[model samples]
Target: MHAFIVTGASRGLGYALCQTLLDDGYFVVGIARNAGPALEGLAARHPERLLAVNADLSDAGQAAASVRTALQQLPLPECATITLINNAGVVTPIAQAGHYPADEVVKAVAINVTAPLLATDALLSATGGLPARRRVLNISSGAAAKAYPGWSVYCATKAALDHFSRSAAVEQEGAANPARVVALYPGVVDTDMQSSIRGSDEVQFPQKARFDALKADGALSSPADAARKIVDHLVSPDFGRQSVVDIREL
Candidate 1:
């Protein structure tokens, strides 16, 4: 049996990925600040296979503890593989760097960068003796490689995550039970994050028009579609071959 851990599992890509994993009979630990009705319903149907953990990713302590708890209670007798997807992120404080709120800046970094690293560290320490095929997937974005006027915080955070994956993968090389790490760009999905981007102040986000056009042109992938593509890559033999990947390139 496969065991999976997903963060930001309340809605959007995270929720869809949890549902997809559950439907395939995989054990899933879902961590979210709030579990919406859809995820709650899925949890109800598969209580044994799906574990729901409530944690605020904005809080570093909560973020790390959630991973420990998720791994601790994971039924591991038949688990053959374990994958951790750090999918929770914040695309906020959508204003120019100088005008950005300090609090929002901190929150963005906590969610986008620190949480994933902490979660990866926690999972590594907790699962050291589990002897399973382990992988850490950081849900990244195109913004990691591009510069957006008002997304300095978001871009910097994602870039940090991508670089972290590269370094972690190297560090884990040749270990007895090493875990593969990859930071993947999942493309522009029609999630709440996109909606928030569309609503940004034009003065703050000059590229708002481009994103608006993507939505208007019906080019954004649906959450479920994106989730499926991502899971396919997650379970693929070629997964983690590239430390940093753009799903669109696959």
Candidate 2:
């Protein structure tokens, strides 16, 4: 069976990805801070295929440990494919760079940047010798390329992730068993992060109206739809041709 390791699987696109992959007959390891009701229902329905792991990725040690645990959960018949979706991210304390607390900035970097880096390292290390098609998908955003009024930290971290993907792809060139890595931007999805952005103070986030208008005009894609599109692209022949992908283009 194929094995998919997905972080932030309690809700939003991460949760939808798990549901979709499981439906397509892949074993999924879902990592999240809390085991919400939705994930619990999924686990109850597919106990053998879905493994829910409660972990706080903000802790530096948690990423590697979580990956190791997920690998242990793989059933017999071994794994034909291994995919790591670094989907956990946060946009908290929305305010001007100077106005936000230093600790909040650190926390945001920990969750958005540090965790993914560590997780990727662990995944490659654990699956290096396995004769399976390996892939890593980093959930990135448009903020990585565009500058937002109060999203300095978020933008910086996502840009970092994109660059990391690019460098990793280059490093994998000519390797015997190379893992395809891509930083994917999932357009504007109607997730909890959107709600947080829409509720932000106008002074801090000047782009609030744009996001609010996106909701009013029904422009944001649903998590399930976005997840389907992303997974479709991941499995496509052209997946790894580009280190960075914007879902809207696909």
Candidate 3:
């Protein structure tokens, strides 16, 4: 059996991933703050396969601990692989570095950087020896590599996640049941997050026009398209050959 634990699974790419995984007969534990109607429909269709967990990832420690306990308790059958996709993230507080509210800044850090790292540790400890191929996919961004004027917090958090993958991948390599980790950059997909980007205050995000143009020209990839490519890579034989991947490059 293949088990996939996905965050932000209520909608967008995360939801698409859950659907795709279930269609292929895999078990999915979807972690979402507000497990929306779409996920509800998925649960209705695949009752035995999809488990939606309602937990806000902003409280990273609590959410991680909760999922760890839940998975450890479930009667999950033997698995070929157990994959964790850290897809929950916030691209908010879009303003110059010093101008963001303290709370928003802290919240973004928790959701973007802290949550994925904690969940990675939690999954490794909880899954036991059931699956030999354990993999972690941290949803990162190009902002991690190239800085944007108003995306200080977003860029920094993604960079932290990417660096964390580098260190964790090496450490996992030596463990008894090592889990391969990759920090992937899923290019500009037309998710609600992209909508938020387009709606940002232009004075703060000067590059908003580029994203606007991308939308106007139909350049953004759909969530389903991106999710399919991502899942294909996740299950491929050479899945973890690299610690970082950009879907566009694939």
Candidate 4:
């Protein structure tokens, strides 16, 4: 059986991705702070295929432990492929760098940057000699490329994830069979994060009007649609052709 480990699986794109993967007959180990109603419902339906792990990805120990728990679900000889989607992220404390809370910055870095690295490490260590194809997909954003006035923390974390994928790709260049790592930009999806951005203080987040306009123009992609597009890109022929990818380009 094919297996996928998806972080942030309780809601938004993560929840949609879990639903899509289960429909495709893949076993999914969902890691999230809270296994919400959607995931709980899916678990009820796919008892054997879905494993909901209530985990706080911002905690280093929990992030690593979640991967270990996922590995335990895939017993020897039965698992065909292992895919890790680092989808959990935060875009908070939207203010000038010095004005943001210190603890919030730390939390953002922990969840958005450190957790993916720790999860990726555990995945590679556990599946190194297995015949299964390993793939690490980081849910990145356009903020990684452009500078947003009040989103310094969010932008920096995404940029770090993108560079990490690039370095991982370089390290796998000569391997006979290497784990594919790609930082995926899912575009502007209509998720809770967008809601948070729209509700932020206008004085601090000057780009609030832009997000509002996107919503007014119906330009935001739905999480379900984004999940379908992302899943299609993940299974595409040219998946690992580039270490950094934009869903629009797919």
Sorted on lDDT, best first, the list reads 1, 4, 2, 3
Q: Which stretches of candidate 4 lie over 4 Å from their true place?
A: 36-38
- Residue range 1-250, candidate 2, lDDT tens digits: 7899999999999999999998887789999888445588888878888987878998979977888888877852478889999999988778887888788888889889999989998988888888888899999998999998899888998999999999988887767899999999999999999999999998999889999999999999999999999989988889899999999987
Model 1 clash pairs are: none
Error of 1 at 54 (Å): 0.5
Runs with alpha carbons beyond 4 Å of true place in candidate 2: 36-38
Query: Which of candidates 1 and 3 is the stronger one according to lDDT?
Result: 1
Name the weakest run of 10 consecutive residues (lDDT summed) in model 2. 69-78
Which residue window of length 10 is worst by lDDT in model 4?
A: 72-81
Ranked candidates (TM-score, high to low): 1, 4, 2, 3
Q: For model 3, what is the alpha-carbon lDDT of residue 143?
A: 91
Q: lDDT of candidate 2 vs native? A: 0.89
After superposition on all CA atoms, what RMSD does each candidate show versus the true structure?
Answer: 1.2, 1.3, 1.5, 1.2
Per residue, candidate 4 scores C-alpha lDDT tens digits across 1-250 of 7899999999999999999999888899899988645588998888889988888988999998999887886773687778999999999878777789899999999999999999998998888888888899999999999999899999999999999999988887776669999999999999999999999988888999999999999999999899999998897778889999999987
Ranked by TM-score, the better of candidates 1 and 3 is: 1
lDDT of 1 by residue, 87-174 (tens): 9998998989789899999999999999999999998888878878899999998889999999999999999999999999999897
Q: What is the C-alpha lDDT of each candidate?
A: 0.92, 0.89, 0.87, 0.90
